[model samples]
Target: MNTSPSPSGAHHVEEGASVRLGALVPLTRPGWVEAGRHLLAGLDLAVTEVNDAGGIGGRPLELVVRDTAADPERAAAAVDDLAGLGVAAVVGEYHSVVARSAAARADALGVPYLCSSAVLDALTEQPTEWVARLAPAQSHGWRIYADFLLGAGRHRIAVVTQPSVYWASGTRILRDHLAARGGTVVELDANELTPEALCDALVDHGATALLLLVGQPEPAVPIVRAVRSDRRLAELLVGAPAGQPEFAEWAAVLGADGAGIPFLRYLPEHLGPLGERVGKELRARLGEAPSFVAFEGWDAVTVLADVLRSHGTDRAAIAGAWPDVAVEGTRGTIRFSRTPGIGVRQWAWPPVQVVDRDPTDADRFRILRTG
Candidate 1:
């Protein structure tokens, strides 16, 4: 997991060694750990392929790793360690809050930060050349959900979100979009999330569809369990798969969704060449499904590698190439603006729905609409 500490001033690449790429990712639980493993595998494969074809600017590549763990304090310290190693730039997997905290540290230290999975608007609302995202912001995903569900007869929507900014504000964008489509937000957070309290909110508001913006399994698991507990109120429950894998550990409990599709941009079990091959390689090394977060780790490395390879110790050339490069990611095309606050210019891989046990194939998630 690359958890060791780096010596001070080690951020600079060796005198004539290939340029180095740095990545920060969460190695611990409740989200994207397995899939992340596979993602890194695919990314390494991409890097190797790039180098084998012919070195960029006649230099090889070095990829470094840092564990961001999901702790704000630890994440802050992590960027410092990475900076000391003279990393060219970074991309990582974690929450937008961590991205925000770490990016500030990275920027001040003169290291650019590009996020691959963290997707909250607050993470990138102010323009900065050193920070950017490879993932789309929350509102974009929410809008897609709102447009499709409302058109498909999901009226009287109830937005069950936690107090987190990721859920509270971003989900509101979906709420506003839905209201514009003639779908009323029947219920908001409704404060107290007790079973009795939730029932009262649903009963009083008469919500027909439920939009879940909650991440972490604590409240999310309970909310889903509560929804499942009352069969009388079953309705559409949906959100990104990145946040649901935590719930997968206790699948028996979270699997309660018999009537909804947990959205996922990339599904590891069903993978392409780079993904399938790398998944196996990572398992051989990491001994797991390669948390999807690993891909964020891997992509961060490859992107930095490709970016730096073009620069060859020229940080400016490296930084400039970042804003408009696109790669065919497992989810879809991954592209971004090197500038920050633009959020990720990328869009979600076309939404894939779980229909009749056939998500293993691409035909499953039909495109009813686009947000």
Candidate 2:
């Protein structure tokens, strides 16, 4: 048995008569490469464990990976290609728009897709039995975030946003939820303003909290720096609901400025035995503390492997097994069902929390709130 890199830069293992699961991740630029790396680490670790435990009933379980690169069209095409390759199922995608495209394609092609991390409420325009998701919908998680803000007395919220379907949806969720609760949400367009100008807008709007809804490292890092340095905004709270500050990259770049900026994460207050063991392996594989996204990857495979054992590798059978998934996962007992307004089978939710890096120790996360 040998593992090698494909010409398209995808990683895969091939042995005779293997059971293949196509993996979609953003391994390149314009995508959240750090998140993708952690996600793939968890997926790979689970596959290794599954193989060690008798190779999915003696047929090797292999991951045929394709880089989505955060492109919806590219993800759709990759789904088609993976289907043609006769994969048992397709799994993993960190970007919601890309996952949406992939879900639609997988539905059309009659393939099973277990979405790992994207959390848009509407994964497909129409309901289909082919797709199931592990992430909490935007409405569920963001409302919890809004509540955290409100509880903290940050009633005036501002979101610095870019033009993207995912960001727009998140902003809408925050806006509607906050509005109903007597909180006001102000929107700042990241396209038209420099980091300094954004700071000025934050001051002008009198927003008690500023949430970064834009991409990272470019405008986000600079914006955080500007906000931290500005004397006028010294009392303002900085937030990133999209989980930008979850990775080590945030602290590596911003140092002390990255701390105390709360973000959303899906994790229980305490890991059970399964979670503890997986967390250790994932940490070794990733060379850092694994994020919740990594756990999602591990759980996706754990559920899929259980399905394959009970339902066999048939696409229709695997898709049919969504409602029957009751496997023990790192987070909790994994299951799926029709959530109101969400188009695909959803996990109801993973544990949702508002957490921030400790100001005194950037490496430690303090749980601010849970929902």
How high is the CA lDDT of each candidate model? Answer: 0.56, 0.90
lDDT per residue (tens digit) for residues 176-195 in model 2: 99999999998899999998
Model 1: lDDT of residue 318: 46
Candidate 1: what lDDT? 0.56
lDDT of 1 by residue, 1-371 (tens): 11121232224466766655666666666434544444456456556766776655666665676666666677778878866666666667566676777766655555667776676766644454556566656655556556666666767877766666666666667668877778787545635577557856776777776655565556666776677777667554443333453323434345434224445342333567766665566566665445455555555555665566555544444445555666665445556643333433343432332222123432233333333
Best by lDDT: 2
For candidate 1, the TM-score is: 0.76
Q: C-alpha displacement of 361 in model 1, angstroms?
A: 12
